[model samples]
Target: MSDDGAHGLTIIAFIGSVFSPYYGWSRAQDPFDHCAMNVVLYGRPGRFAMTERKAGSLSRSQDHIAIGPSSMHWDGTELTVRIDERGAPVPRPIRGTIRLRPSGITAGPFHLDAGERHRWWPMAPASRVEVALTEPGLSWQGSGYFDTNDGDEPLSDAFTSWTWCRAELPDGAAILYDVNHRNGGGRSLSLRFGFDGARRDIRPPLPAALPPTGFWRMPRATRSDDGRSRVLQTFEDTPFYSRSLLASTLAGEPVRAVHESLSLGRFRNPLVQLMLPFKMPRPL
Candidate 1:
């Protein structure tokens, strides 16, 4: 999962028994379990730093996740993060503290598959972010978001394509979740929720395509209520997924949102599977 604030982004990734043998998964017992951390300071272009540790090095209780020099603690009300970059690979240095308090609205534990193989829970659909960075010396605060994705089986086994986006409104927030499955079926969720914890399902607008990715020709699109959608920034474009920041409207309100598209069909390709090791090298 990742947290994107106004000034920085932090990602905490956990690969379970399936993806353990790669990406520096733990070697102590089951060589396949691992956890990794990444921090990016938006001011420094190309200054993304990542660190990987064995699964045993991570500790996850009810509301806290601690690994190496970084930790995220959620106390049912607010989420707090403390990042220490002294062990990271990049040289320029990056470290910070972040706090996110929910606006009291959430969406789903929504089932993505008919058999309940995959699910999504929008824990904090909209949040107030407070940031304090000491490494390169920066400080700012703004709106933020948090969520979770979980599956009982591999993604390739159930899904072919998906597009998800969240927009923060003046009074609350909205989310559009659309998915296409491999079995010739699909699901769509257009939900709007308020800070007071009221949620309603609405119909989303037509799909609008964004520009294709540079390398893989991976397609990207989002549903906007006004038929106007623009890509503001492309954060990640891989063989099977694309993550971007977009300018769009939801429920008639102008919104700047984080958007993502995943192509499980591409991920199932033999060549894409072969290339995964390069991006996620395992430790010997």
Candidate 2:
């Protein structure tokens, strides 16, 4: 019985439980489980997720990351991710937006309506990314030189976390897409899938279970005399049961950029059980 309210949010808490030290080092007062949601879209380029992360004290001040609905000038290609720092009292919202192109080798421009704004470049020396939709969702696989700001000093304090994600198919296909993350000296391997029908209350002291049977693949990057970084990554796809994988990746708000092949699973709205079986996911 995995309760969605273990820490506070779903994604962060879920990942922290199964894998130790969830996302970087989190303080007791600043738990990473604040209020975070991960959303993804099955597009032609690949699966893009919009994850909203609010790590402050109050939930009302929770920031948002979303792909704004097609408007007049901008459409799907343009993504709007808002990181608002709501102040005291009425909680002011500081939002932002990001504009991306279809090119797989270029970086995108990010604009913050409030907080910080900058352009983020893609991993250099791009690799061929192949994605296929399997019934319930889509599956993808790719490789590239992940950017890294090695710990040189205070000014050069940036780390580009690198990894891969493989999601299972919906309708229960048994094949699981394993995601691997390598950062610093620590690494995390998790499965972003569905709840196995065994739901629980959305409150404290929540219980959860990490999916069994998943492996990690290590990749080494090499550079040629021509200044092209070539990557050789290896990932092992494991099956949970005999055939019960996810369909497509879940949808929420975008968080970080990920590279992997994911299978979106069936979306069982717990909202329907609000009046009967289960409870709603806290508040928005």
Candidate 3:
């Protein structure tokens, strides 16, 4: 997200893109064979690009990851990203560079399901990001968050759905993870991390209701002081997921949070999977 909240971007480097129809059909194949650098720009003339490449187009190391024309590297201090991709369905350019400097990195390996098949890590709960895009010519600096998730089994094997939110507070960042399992149970994780590398599990605020996404109407909400949150902006709204900017009170302080609601159940639907290719095409 931009410092002024006017521009925002999401770049997801995927090795076995969970949303790829190619990966869906080749589940028994090598994960690296179905990879992509998923990029989403949220501003005027917004764009969405995800080009699934073959195994020969992927590379990785201790501090770097490259998928096709885009790559990201961490050199102890700042993480640098280079992007060179074109939007699908119409093919528009989206080339850019992003630099993220984490205020602090945290240690996390939390389980999101009872079977311990899925894990999540809040690598850096607080940071600053600079998004400089040359293709569309947009640039901004803003507060940011970084995290990673991995699973021994497919996500659909464990989670039915989940809601996550990350709010930057005066001192640090607060995050909430609510997960519903396939077997009819769920878990909630509430955590606070300081910009100075301090982290602690905290009592989550009361649950607040918010309006659903306009197109998908995907259920969305957050933890807040009065159990009332409002939608500030809806960034991405797909059949199975929604990302939005939310305004609410947390820990007695008014805060703006980046929230996401994902439904793996919907993702598993054959029709939804078929429709994904329109937005996530694989370029051979």
lDDT of each: 0.71, 0.23, 0.87
Q: Residue 68 lDDT in model 2?
A: 25
Each prediction's total of clashing residue pairs, residues at least 3 apart in sequence or on different chains, is 3, 32, 0
Q: How would the candidate models be sorted by lDDT, starting from the highest?
A: 3, 1, 2
lDDT of 2 at 163: 26
- On a 0 to 100 scale, what is the lDDT of residue 184 in model 3? 93
**Tens digit of lDDT per residue, candidate 3, span 52-150?**
899999999999999988999999999999999999876998999999999998876788877788889999899999888998888889998888878
lDDT per residue as tens, model 1, 67-100:
6678899887889988875433335666788898
Cα misplacement distance, residue 215 of candidate 2 (Å): 23
- RMSD in Å for model 1: 3.8
- Model 2 per-residue lDDT tens digits across residues 169-239: 23110111222221234223222222232212211111112232234222222111122221122122311
Question: Compared to the true structure, candidate 1 yields what TM-score?
Answer: 0.83
Most accurate candidate by TM-score: 3
**Which of candidates 2 and 3 is the stronger one according to TM-score?**
3
Q: Specify the highest-lDDT model's number.
A: 3
Candidate 2 local distance difference test against the native: 0.23
